[model samples]
Target: MYSPVQPMHIPDGFLSTLVSIVFWVISIVVLGYALKRVGKDLGERQMPLMGVLAAAIFAGQMLNFSVAGGTSGHLLGATLATILLGPWAAMIVMTSVASIQALIFQDGGLLALGANLFNMAVIGVMVSYFTYTSVQKLARGKAWGIFTGGALAAWTSIVIASLAAALQLALSGTSPANIAVPAMGGIHMIIGLGEGLITFGALAFLYATRRDLFHVGEAAPKGSKAIWVGGLAIAALLAVLSPLASTHPDGLEWVAGQKGFLEAARAPLYNLVPNYVFPGISNGSLATIVAGIIGVVLVFAVALGVAYLRRGRKRSK
Candidate 1:
């Protein structure tokens, strides 16, 4: 559920060094494109909210919910962020979250940074963008429709990314295609439900509070009961249920175990650090709580820093 690094769950050595290097290159190129687009689309006021939204997404990811059996799932929050901030900004936020998780928690391998970014940032953000847009058109801005669309889009993106990872593993000969793809896809399908529900509820609340925020061709709106109360309620639910999330191995782990690659999976070098526990922090319930706090702080800092830089550059120009 709440693996220390969250979304970038492909374990160390899952993909070969060569494959990982290629993913890194692809991720950088895509990220640069996303940033350029975001810099142009987002306005000054949106920056602060974007920072808060990033922190919220990071924190939400740490709150794992039990799926089927002993398996667990957590919110990607990409769908929610994209619905609020649009795809380009969502990519920046998600990439920052993934980067911090890798650097601070050592959960995702640096070598696979590009792969992770591509999966979570590019697919999650951009694909969801189109999906939600289609849904919004169909729903015609109805709250329920928008919420449903966002949820589905978020869920779909995760499944697609999972498939992509499976393909990489198969191509690398780390595992057979027959074994890896379906196994990963099956588990992630279950996980995607949780992601959808979370995204839906968050978006619904945001829309309720700041209806203006969702308006086409306008700056993101500020404040309302929906924002404050909805956010609090969601956070409370996460805190209460996070500890009960699934203990079983996730999609990647399940594939690795079944395909006989689990043994060959080398732990990242950085993971040798004392703090690099799979469960992270204390291996207790508090682990998620602590991780959530850390995630919130890290995302806030990174988002603010990015926003500040963008603003400074604009002012100079």
Candidate 2:
């Protein structure tokens, strides 16, 4: 059976009810603040950028790469998004990505969405922003310094998110903190390197071409159309290639299996595009590709909508 690409997210049954509710409340509070902060500073050109970033992040998450011990990991994209679009905007983008994955693809448990959002979208983005900014300040904003900052920021974000997930699992009695933390943290340490390299490479590419995108809203950047087209094209390409992603179990799944809690995971309450395979598609690969493309479009649309709403709110105030 073909399994959809799954990230290192906690599935239902892995977390206790109280733990889940606590995270949900925390996530809601943080996201509410994010909306307010974003509304105050959202720019006209940012709508397209948000859409493109969300699409790219969603598509990128579908590509799982193999790691040690037969486990696999995928890009979290929190650091990359936070660096490109500020922490507030990045949180919104990450939320859209995680929510769509859970609701549409069933990649994550619906009940666990709150914890997932808190770990990856909220905490992850905030850590990235602060780390990257601190590094840039220390380096005095040199080119290498900025690139290094992005790389470090990306790595730090993944590790911290992993630790947070482990802590949650521990709190939920899914595993002991000592064991869960080391296991989760160790594996993600390697995974974070990949994220760091990817983030660094992306920053370098942007530095080489379309550097203006780094500070787009600060001034009117030319070739805006080309930037948008190129971004979407990249996302589409990733979606098409998603079928080739690693088939190995993801970090969380692997840990669950090893820790003897894999059986605890429950089935999704509903299914839309279950496991990224569109229904009625005879070919699994084709189904996944189509599903991924649809996901890209959906994420882009959601991000655009959020940006528009925030912009409208700003105007009204």
Candidate 3:
């Protein structure tokens, strides 16, 4: 059976029709609010950063690291996105990214788009933002506190997303809560470790490189050369290391297999690039690398287009 590498991107036929519709409605509403909230802080200067960061996020998701116990997990980047672009923008960026993954890449079910977006975008970003801010305040601005807060928030977001996915499955009668919860929660508990560490390390890099960055309404550092170089480096790394990613099923896939629902997944709306496989590419590794690059470029363009349009609207107003 086929499997996805991303977390909580529940394919079609897994969720009840009602559950899917509810999530879609909920996600759309949240996204509307997210746009308005983000508009307040997304100055023109921040637009380009969103595109580049979106690219980085897209690339990052392609590289799944092992979580041990025969499971794997990729970066959620929701918490990290919150740190970079703030919660609102992160939500928008993440949702857009997830949507593209579903539509063009065929990585997720179109009917299930709403649920996946809700779990990864709304829940992940919103919960992580609150957790990070609270921890930062409680820690009183120390580097350790701030960094630790990021780590905690990253881990929390992953765990919560996992639980939400489990809840969706349970509500759909796909699996028992007792079975889904522990399996998802336990596996993700370990997956969350990498999420936290990566989040903290990225934050530390930013702090060391540009302290004024990530503040509300603040633009990226004026010395942007380093940022560009870093972003490119990350994108390149994702392209290179992705094919080397653990072939083991990710946490969600592993759980589904154990729970016997892995076979329930259905074809996406379109398979333009099924499994992130690029058309006309026979070689598996090369296809994945090409697909990774394409995803980055596509994500960058989408983010830039949105930011550009948002700026245009503001100017018109």
Candidate 4:
């Protein structure tokens, strides 16, 4: 489902330097605005939840499963975040996770961090959030409304992100539109199925067990047996399923290969914790599991720090 090192992340050379820089500027501006406004109006109570939800997203990505045709994909969790925390908070959380993945885990390239965030964080959240809200409006009162909204948004996020990446790669001269678009779009359609089902299932689970958490200002849902089960399930996936996940490269990597630009991907400058390995973890399976767990914790701390800072600002002002 994941290459462990690269998943859907755009590597350094995949995008032109100018394109990367442009996205960096855009992403930073959006992130700055989100940090100042996202949860500020909701009060500080929802801050810590940013960390907890980011951890769940990190864990969920590690459990990527097969879709079809030897291709696989992982969760972006943008819709899930938007559903529980609103669009602004969801964008901040996704950006935080992507930044951490690029720097600490080397899951994405430093130069391309902007593009990565632009694709998976900004675009993913915007498309999913709008889609979910529109669907929710039309499907009100039905038990399936929430789940269907989640599924549609999740699926669209993947397809839209994939198309965006393909266009960027073409503009960067890494791949031609004819080859890149069709290949990327086709595979991601299947991958989106997995993302949609998982997202819908997750939404259903949350609504049933943690409905209090649906809105940003409400009290945090108390930890129940279901919460424990969900936590354990996430842990089990990292410890067990991550190691057993399909070894094939995910959708982006596969498309790169098919479009004859796989080698266009270059390594990051420092490669800190390259391939998500904790230096000296020689066992491939063990490294994957350990790396995933470490990444989850790292992102958790990052989100927590951001939340704390925001809370402090609110308290002072």
Reference-based lDDT, residue 153, model 4: 82
Clash-forming residue pairs, model 2:
none
Candidate 1 ranges beyond 4 A from true positions: 5-8, 67-71, 216-317
lDDT of prediction 1: 0.68
Find the 10 residues in a row with the least total lDDT in model 4: 240-249
Q: What is the model-wide C-alpha lDDT for candidate 4? A: 0.71
Whole-model Cα lDDT per candidate?
0.68, 0.72, 0.72, 0.71
lDDT of 3: 0.72
lDDT (10s digit) by residue, model 3, range 1-317: 33355546788898877678888998898788777766665698767877788778888876676767877666778888877776777888898788888887787789999999987887777667667766876876777866898899888777777777876776666766657766776777888998898888888998999988757334433323332343234334422332222232254345444543333343343354465454558677887899999999999999999999999999999
Please write out the lDDT profile of model 1 over residues 1-317, one tens digit for every residue. Answer: 54553434566677776567778887788678767766766578768877787888778877877767776777878778777776667778989887877777777767777777777787676667656766766887566678888888877777767766766676455766666666776767777888888887877787778887776645432322232243234334322322221222253345444654433454554456655455455476777788899999999999999999999999999
Q: Candidate 3, TM-score vs. the true structure?
A: 0.64
State how far residue 110 of model 3 sits from its true place (Å). Answer: 1.1
Q: After superposition, how far is residue 211 of candidate 3 from its true place, in Å?
A: 1.6
Q: Is candidate 1 or candidate 3 better by lDDT?
A: 3
Which candidate do you rate higher for TM-score, 1 or 2?
A: 2
lDDT at 63 for candidate 4? 77
